[model samples]
Target: MNITTLSILQQEYPKLMEDGIIQSNVPLKEHCSFQIGGPAEVFCTPYTQNQLLDLLRFCLNHKTPYFILGKGSNLLISDKGLSGIVISTERFTELTVEQEYITASCGVTLKDLCNYACENGLSGLEFASGIPGSVGGAVFMNAGAYNYEIKDVLHSSVCILPTWESINSLSPILYLKVEEHNFSYRHSVLQDKELIHLSSVFHLKRDNSETIKRRMDEYQQKRQQKQPLELPSAGSVFRRPEGFYTGRLIEDCGLKGFRIGDAAISEKHCGFIVNLGSATAKDVLQLIQHIQEVVYEHYNVKLQTEIRFLGEM
Candidate 1:
């Protein structure tokens, strides 16, 4: 079940901790760009799929709750801390290029992937260059900007599917075709299934490195100008509602720069809620709730959070 406790893991995998793959009482703020989470009771980083599979099996069997941590860009963990083990995919960074295809492991950053593609004279991922997320997180969310999404260039993916019955073969390893992803705006099949993405293949067309770099630089410049890059935030707090821009709505509601303790709506960008030194999860939650209430009352639009919250508020 992987959702009960983690004592057995610590006892059985003592060597893993000694090898630096497992840790205890790890502060999650250090891992995420938001710098707002408390601590994780247990934390693990497995370098290979085999190791990950073994850990997964153990967790599933032992009913120890575990949360996957990828990039940590879009999360708002609890100030009270999380009780379960956190499995970080940061070390799963194997990347390769073969002709028009680029294969990257789960932990590969979008920036590195884009740069690698550019270096190889490949194009199509330039729009993802400035995104602060890992490949797995990006794919899981079908993350996109500038009218391009991961679904556009995704060729295939390797993942693990957990089901009670036979899933084509005895092995859990699956090669998911792009057509089977069921992708939509900011969502992928992974969000609806108990699947773990291991790696992916992206198809890109040939292009001049200079041209690709220029496009990438243009996008990065836009992000720096429009977003609150100087502040600690979990990117945009709300998903853009149809026919309405979230940031604009918040700004129109006179809620920009609103504060709840150390958590405040970014003065530069209304969509973001930034942590202004020693902000707690409680503060962010209160701020988010206030924003939602105020926006709904003013514009009849219920702001839905894009950021994933974990643990107790």
Candidate 2:
């Protein structure tokens, strides 16, 4: 643990400390969907925009390394854990419905957004009904399923860009239109930018409430039937390699049901690597490497992981 860093944060943000905004030695495993990771040095959850900005400023001023965490749906933290601070947007859960659009905070889950859209007789978000991630995470990764993506409905987003100068004079907040995001297959401009996603505006169309519900139900059914939802695993382990489905390739390589410690290639879905019971980050990593090597050796195509890796091994 970095005692000096923790002391500085507590001292600098006394009010936040008093309010229990900052926490020490938080377990990353409990926060993420994978349920596999060590501890984070410090964890902070800011409920409002101003509070989030204040935390960002403090980190900037101290030159401290920090990570912005959402629902932790698509990540693999090392067993040794993260070194610095983790800022969670979990409490930024505000949602509003306009006539033909829905605006949601970064912390709002994709499931909630889909349900809200349906309740309001809005369409276009049904594709994301089953994605177990936050709005910020979906936008950041251009998360998509069944031929639909966040970029298709996202109108704009309010983002906070970090500046190299002093935090006292913080950088201007940007209202980035969807086109400015430079979205592509499973990627967005936010990936390369030093910005914090605050909220997103999605332009949707009014549709029959029953129709929207039906579509959502269909998608949810497909997800349940095809994915290993009963197990604790990151949704997908690898990106779709051009012109080929990653799951098919892995299955063809006869690597289905392959295991390393408790981390096993899901028998139900070759695309996912699930924790049978007591999987470690090291177990998952080794299994991933082995699959990549075998698949590459047989098909001469390298597989790239879709999930982000955080912390050291």
Instruction: Return the top candidate by TM-score.
Output: 2
Please, what are the lDDT tens digits per residue for candidate 2 over residues 86-106? Answer: 999999899999899899999
lDDT by residue for model 1 (33-149), tens? 889888888888999776777677766766667788899999999986787678999999999999999999999999999999999999999999998999999999999999999
Runs in model 1 with CA error above 4 Å?
1-7, 163-170
TM-score of 2: 0.98
Count of steric clashes across candidates, in order: 5, 0
lDDT of 2 at 295: 91
Whole-model Cα lDDT per candidate? 0.88, 0.91
Model 2 residue 60 lDDT score: 80
Q: Return the TM-score for candidate 1, rounded to 2 decimals.
A: 0.95
How much is 44 displaced in model 1, in angstroms? 0.2
